[model samples]
Target: MEQQRAAHSTEAVVGMVAQTFLRDRHQFVGELSQLMRTQLPVLDRDERLRELMEAGTTDNLMEILQFLQNEAGEDDVRAPERALAYARILAQRDVPAAALIRAYRVGQAGFLDTGMRYAIEFGGGGPVTTSAIVHIVNRTSVYIDRVCEQVGVAYEDERDRWSGNRSGLQRQWVTRLLDGTVTDTDAAEQYLRYPLSRGHLGIRAWTGPQLDPATAATVFDQLRTALTTVFGRAHATLVVPVDDHEIRMWLAWPAGTAVDSGAIARALTARGVPVRVAIGGYGTGLAGFRRTAAQAGRVRRLALLGGDHGARVLAHADVAAVALLAGDIEALREFVADQLGELAVDNERNLWLRETLRVFLAVNRSYAAAATRLAVHRNTVQYRVRQALDMIGPHADVPGGDLYPRLALQATELLGTAVLRPEPDRN
Candidate 1:
């Protein structure tokens, strides 16, 4: 630890550390160097810090000191990493000063014992402001107010992720895997190189044809690679196989990427899949992303449902009717209605089954609750589900899994809208 601290003498090491809190590393280092250079007054400092400021310590300490002093502390203006780490040591020991913790280390999150992330800030970090700070208290208060707006969103996002980890999140190797962004795979967050990405902003798409599982899977692979090319290497593991057919898929990504509509449209056209990319609108953090991605999935369904000619894809705009299209809600319903719905010995039973289907969808086709609501034994529920499957016949297994059940529900809902349930935000 001491050696590492001593390594701070090297500008490269200091730059690496500084990156933990600020954006634009090279630019930040330049400005910081300038500040230290101008304000340095003397290369030597009080005994404790002198070891870090020795002329031989780093090539640029004196220069950086000048920048810090010349810029009058403004040189460290966005040095959130340094400030955050500085704050961490203080906070860990219970200093409780206002501070901003920098973004997560590339793969250094597991060490984050509490998992209580403050926010999903694009910039590094800042002081957690409330009613503190003696000087600039008013200014800090205003900025803190402004930051709070974002903080709520970021905080909520982290919380959602926490919940996902508990009851919902996908598998480690398969579901939540991060492949490192295209721009940053070769870059090391540990070394302070920027995470070169599509601005940490973009969407992960569900791609492929409903008819061909092989084709869909191939398309999945292609688009995974293609989108990676477009957005640069971004995390794709959040995407799950939607159906038996490999063509259908789902993706989640950080916001603010350059893979816009026209570009995606053109790319898909060139690739022969002819895509409809759903731009999950601008929201903060991962929870915001999941919400947006689900919205995008719905939009894709809507577009495909819209009977839009040619190969179909969905972007954010098509959300209004995400449900009506996607797959066989009717089949799913028919499957449910046959298996579970038919259990209704009367009209009320039918209504109950309808409610069951609604619940299933609201819960993203979860099986356990669908049984509980029906007020039957789980095995009986399972048996009924099997029976429904038998009744629907082979088409029920239509690839791109979301469809059969989705289409079934769609048909049922279309036939009986007043009776169906609303799809929850899943937020």
Candidate 2:
């Protein structure tokens, strides 16, 4: 009779605990949703509020409650499956595991505080009920710890799985085509599912390493959207998967498609992906694709060398002058030093002089125009131009002598070098 009575009382306490949670489900979920937004910076975005709120109020809340209520705790068979599925959802949405774990810890604290208080008040504040509340709190803590560990395991497993096949057969096919390794163009094109016989305009884009891979994927998606917006979805076909850090795209438009490379560059740059793009002119067939891609590669190299020129957006046509002078770096360095004479010397005053000369030449040697662009008085511009002319002397005076100085300035702007200093002595 005694044992039976104790067993009945224990069952009633468990029922009371579960009832307290279920009765206030709306209040509980609402509070928890607030906690999630406050704790998880990634979930704090206005676009993410709906998803974050759903995690607390929908079927997921029930699944989480079930794991917490199970007597077997983490040993419950459903627990791993539930945790794995939830983790996969987060992974697919590109939420980091650390953020999810932090959110879970925050939820744990909220659940224990609210649930324990409800359990005690529901038990009418007696000594026996207070002891029971303590037991419930201890049990809840252990249950939450076990569930969290299991969920973390699931998150890591899903993350590992994500990195497995992200760069696979498609990447291999595209890479082989780009390198000119495969001669069977038809077989390659079929494998790649890209039309090689059609006109192609190649593009190469890449982001800095500071972006995480999942974030990089989002950036790449934005790049695709920008391309589609500029070129129309039908024309911007063939987004060849080229791993996380870089993308190689080909637009299958007609030969006479009026592609403003400047507009395309601006569209992609506006997406703010920390991306630099190289756009190539349209050409037909396999050879055309390869040639355009090569041109894009050269333009990309120049963009890298150019530094922050407004933004890192380049096109083959805009970079043609730099491309013509690509070979022999040492000779180019010598030419810059010789053409500009004493003006190429590395000093603050000389740098100011070189910049003035560059601006003057860029505006067709108009002193007034250069002054307007540089925000200086026209007399300052005239004085600076005369001084620079004296420093450059007859080296830039012959027929097309201006060409050498102009090319030197252009090389300095594109290559980031006016002169190469001699190596220091190892004394």
Candidate 3:
């Protein structure tokens, strides 16, 4: 009976400590997440992965706390859903299984240390303290062991499933190429079955998530075929599905081959694919491969940020200036506002004036050329330019010419109302 009472007392102490930690869950989660990200850099790759790591940490901590508070058997323990999801993502991302295991081990050690501190505080460093610590260690170890085993299974299953297909193999090679892990161009070419020494153009295509899987697959396949024909029938093309709604493609052609973006856009429209595309500059050899892919990625990000501005195809060359300026959106907006002033307002009249000024400046301030481009009379173009310049103040006529106003106008064209002062609601 005395031993039974002692066991009850230890259990109560462990539960109390767990309760204390549970109340301070946020801090514990932050510490664990920071530790995981620091120790396992793979988990820190992107915002989505970091978010998953934090969520998994929180779920695992909650599960551990609940286990400590209850008298659950070891067999009853299971890994949390979010933790399993995180393990699967790591697998999909080609992170090593060892790294996933180390994350658990790291987390287990940290949790144990924290639990020991609480146990010592509650039991006051006596026999009760020793008993409480022992109880905590055994239970926590069981929990970690069981959860790790489950997550390991999940990771392996996902890795097997993901690596079983052709897209998986392509993704692995593409990832290696992009990350500069493969330095031998011949070996990479042999593995990818595409010559790395040839000229390369990278493309990113994506559709809305509203498309069903079958429709998305068909659209992507059509895009691949269309691009292959557009680049040239003789050249090699590689297409990798990024996800359900997106794909990354690389087209290789012999040196000096001309790529017509207009033709590519027309072909997609002909097929009614209903997709948006970001095209990178044409580059040659291994350096070109990486550079073009990076450019396409940046353009894709800019496109997503700007929303649908009637631009079905965005090329890196065209948006390079805007893309660079858009890196710091707030600063870019401030620059636009500072340069254009009232011309940055998001209204019909201001938009027309901005466009006329942009065209006038683009065509070397030639009134006739700007009028031709705008499909308006030269008098009207001249009038709008004068009005725009007046609204823009003396800065538009800055000593160095239209450099500042030109950049702001380009941003206004690409970003639309994003950098513009909002139009007041009619309501």
Candidate number with greatest TM-score: 3
Candidate 2 per-residue C-alpha lDDT over 255-294 given as tens digits, one digit per residue, 9 for 90 to 100: 6766666786778657665677777767888888888887
lDDT of 3 by residue, 1-427 (tens): 2222323368777877888788899998899888988999977764446667888989999998888778899899999988987787788777888888898899999999999987777776778889889888888899999999999999999889878888788888888899989767677788778878888888888876457657988998888888777765747877887755678988886666665667878999998988888888889988899999989988787676677554778888788877778777898999999999989889999989999999998888899999999999999998998999999987666546788889999888888877888977889
Candidate 1 lDDT over residue span 1-427, tens digit each:
3323323122333233233324343443344433443444232121212222222123232223233223234323232222222222222222222212221121112111111121112112333211111122232333333333343344444345433542123222223323322233333222322232222332434433223445655666666666665656655433443222222233444665544565666667678763345455544343443355555545544443334342344445433343433355444343534433333222443444444544555555557877776676667655555554443445543344535455444434333432233443558
What's the lDDT for all of these models?
Answer: 0.38, 0.66, 0.83
RMSD (Cα, Å) for all candidates, in order, is 23.7, 16.8, 8.9
Q: Each model's number of backbone clashes?
A: 69, 0, 0
Candidate 1, residue 90: how far the Cα is off, in Å: 54
In model 2, residue pairs whose N, Cα or C atoms come closer than 3 Å (at least 3 residues apart or on different chains), thus clashing, are none
Candidate scoring better on lDDT of 1 and 2: 2
Ranking by TM-score: 3, 2, 1
